[model samples]
Target chain A: MAEPSWSNALEALADNKFVLGDQLVDVGISAPELASALAAVAMAQGELGHARHLYHWSHELQGISKEIRAESGKALSVLRHHENWIELMVSLLAVNVAARVLLERLRQLNEAMVVSKTAKMLVEMAEHITFAGEWCRRFRAETGAIPGLFQAALSRQSDAICAWLRAVDAEIGGGSDMDMANAFVREMEMVCGPVTVRHPA
Target chain B: MSTSVEYRAYAVFARSQRGGPLYQIGFVEAFSDALAKTYANLTYDEENWFELCVVPLDELRWVIEPQGVSAKGESGRGGAIVEQRAGSAG
Candidate 1:
């Protein structure tokens, strides 16, 4: 496949953010506590704001109109294919953590616009990662079934996650696919410990 | 099954700028001091604070009479005494 331009990558990132934010807003209605629900709402608003920023940046950088850019449906299908809240949380935790790492590296780019935008996004993403980590920890402590649920979610979505990483790598030329996957898994383990899942033979 | 965890209440204070007075912004509940700080930071970071801190609600000592209330005022202080309880505040 031909490598995607920086503009295309930004578009994809924006779509992913929108999808993630939308899902969070939907799931937040059922949050166990008012505090957790409010946190989810805050995170959803932040992610949506980031998406708008990226979309506007892409439009300006590539001379694409906002209307045209908005019509582009490049969101990840994996996010739409979740089975449960636990699955959604696991997938979001993994994807957002990995995206944070990639965005950090992208901030090293010499382009002033890219550096500034990436820095702003990184600060917000740090809070997202922290919130996700804390939620995962709470799930583990309260549910007692989070490890198994996470493992099942990971096994089900591994392919999509790997493909997403590959596409991001192709666009940005950062870490290898294996390296990114390992980093994501390590972060997941830190949040929820060793997840064990049985694979179909 | 969802397990219930007792979250300690923390009172948050923030200074809007350098050398400014630290005013009470809000409160948050968490299972630990670290989580309380995180919750406080996440929930009350709308402003550009010069500094922020969180202390357990139980740690604060309430002044019942503000140093110079007469015996008449003391009779009406029952409400303040009840409100000072840790559980009541939380």
Candidate 2:
């Protein structure tokens, strides 16, 4: 197979298409798990691209060196070597952030979709909402807006609420609704400190 | 505005104070290390207990995470705890 261009890899991941066997063989990955591995790598690559874009924006905003400025646009360079864990992790964080932002855009696009209609659905959606806010504020800060610590704290709390949602999703399949709700409340306390989750009458 | 090569001071930490975590704290936009250091120190000193560090823009650790604040005191509970405890301890 021909060498994978950056664009092809990103498009594949975004579309959720499995990487072909030829590509996997070229990379020396086994045949059976090639699809999963390819998906992971493609997703990782896409994430790096998004991170690179954000990092470049921040660098431009902050007036860093031209050399540094250039590197910000090439997040894929950070992941060239599997051993580059720091850059890889950074790239992953950026992707996680982009996922969140996309989720929010989806929600805003369809305002009628209230989360609380189903506990499981709500938790899943809430994670996306909270994560989006966190990434946006960080993006702003990195780009020189200088958000206060309190604002950052608000982002963290939003994450906590998202965590509570995940727990509810897990419990929806089997546990009693009341117990699931109670567990979610407990998780919320762990993430954001103590808080009440009173339901409307 | 100037394109001078400079370091961005950061206060790196894990999400839950765990042994192994990503570099959550991000870049400082100041020009000089001293200015960056000062900014990092003033801002992160209390939160990460002043474990401030510096890196160039190219070297910055960029593991950003989403977080939120709660009045219940989970996120930045330090400010509340320290102020309350300081009076009693002193």
Highest TM-score against the true fold, candidate: 1
Residue-wise C-alpha lDDT for candidate 1, range B9-75, written one tens digit per residue: 9999999999889899999987767567667877896998999999998898887535333333544
> Which 10-residue span in candidate 2 chain B carries the lowest summed lDDT?
B1-10
lDDT of 1 by residue, A19-138 (tens): 888888887656666776677777788888888987887777677665633525887787755555666666567667766755655565666766777787877787676666666666
RMSD of each: 6.6, 23.1
**Model 1 chain A, poorest ten-residue lDDT window?**
A192-201
lDDT of 2 by residue, B1-90 (tens): 113334344443424354544555754554444434434443444454423465655564559733433233554534655666668998
Off by over 4 Å in 2: A1-32, A68-201, B1-90
How far is A161's C-alpha from truth in model 1 (Å)? 2.4
Give each prediction's DockQ, rounded to 2 decimals: 0.28, 0.01
Interface RMSD against the true structure, candidate 1 = 2.7
